[model samples]
Target: MSSDNWTEQDVPDQRGRVAIVTGANTGLGFETARTLAARGAKVVLAVRDAGKGKQAAARIAGDVTVQTLDLTSLDSVRSAAAELREAHPRIDLLINNAGVMYTPKRTTADGFELQFGTNHLGHFALTGLLLDRLLPVPGSRVVTVSSTGHRIRAAIHFDDLQWERAYSRTGAYGQSKLANLMFTYALQRRLARHSTTVATAAHPGVSNTELIRNTPAPLRLPVTWLAPLLTQKPEMGALPTLRAATDPAANGGDYYGPGGMGELRGTPKRVASSPASHDEAVQERLWTVSEELTGVTFPVE
Candidate 1:
């Protein structure tokens, strides 16, 4: 989309919808939840910290619910999912919004690398586990928040996905974000082939968010100074995601991001990806590997 295209007011009617926004306590996630709720959707703030999430929702000025969801733990994922299923019964939208970046090497409670485990695997399992309920409610959508880092950090080291052999915080972060996009595209293709639920991805162009709190001082110094000049506010970056989740014109497999300065910061825009990302083989492999790792197959058929 052009920079001068549709504005936030262009967001479509979202009444009667129920959205589950992971990490809805702050950053882009919080803005997403707030927008959805204000638009009349019952937004559920799924976060790791219930207290913080409650406070965030309380400030949203809309219908918002607080729910605990720690993406680093499969057991936590399962429990939170079960709670949502039991309580809401159906979820019309799922915003895979939580993520970690440039952190010290660590593993999730499930033993997988922290970045991939939480950003990709957790959402993989959560979406698959909740598939039944989501499918029952027609026109449901799953929006995975991704990033431009995929361009800098291509290639999935299947041999050592945990990065025990080699680890660079930036590289690991990029790989994880790429996996989010790959999963989004692959899942959308799978759904088109055999199902109806739509899958889409978006990136908040260098938005100032807490995802970078743990970033190295060297990296943070430049980012801290450059963000205000180059990055859009979290609310602005959240617009593309909101569009993906609510707009009926949003097609499955389409990607949205900033259109200005190499997609770094601008109004919401639909963009393309590298050829490697578009490779069908890689996406299928990633999908199969994800299913095996999570032990939760998304039966799109």
Candidate 2:
């Protein structure tokens, strides 16, 4: 992400580091996992589908394990974390990269809006539960993959955080993405006050991934044909997150993404969050709501 020349070979040897990539079976997640594993990190693929997860792990050219993790369900999230902790006590990287985008309103098994629940709350819970392990590991990091969509709806409606009253898929996605950035910012602050874990965020910039298959055909065409022009490949998209994780100089709370037109697609560059995302009050409120909703506590706990 630092430059287009950055490659997996540039990463230092990480033979002892243990890393986890949520939704690591495809797209940017897959590339992140593959590169991490290739770099000698003990990589775990936290995926929702077992079959696909195994397939993904198999495709990676390094040591990797695939575990079932459905972020939308607290039960699934807890079970996966418990299963992971039973075997691996040290974690070096936690990539909150699995996400759903612009889904037509659908309720999760827990009866929450799908996009927000899966994209943010699931990760919120997973990271909280794993803090015990992450905090103990030396030089550990947490990478939250956010988006430029955050510039759209940075508002946190305390009373209606789930988009129940007014539902716009795009609006909800934007809100969730902003929540990701806000969470990343607040998390880094909290970690600074408590643990050594660094929390950073990344954006894939219109990468061609299965993440967009659910969209309408018309909407998919332009992206499919023009993504090479406007979007970086999934491998390119993963670099920003990878750089944040492995780069010696990358800092906590620094958001990385493509450096191309309007920040759409190119090599990774350190970028600023919208002024709205800089609101400490809103971040604190969102953190409180997330904890209450996910039943996971952070530094205070």
Cα-based TM-score, every candidate? 0.96, 0.95
Clashes of 1: 1
CA-RMSD of model 1: 1.6
Worst 10 residues of 1 by lDDT: 1-10
How many collisions per candidate? Answer: 1, 0
Tens-digit lDDT track of model 2 for 43-73: 9999999899999888888789988999989
Residue pairs in collision within model 2: none
RMSD of 2: 1.7
Off by over 4 Å in 1: 1-3
Q: Which parts of model 2 have CA positions greater than 4 angstroms off? A: 1-5, 216-218
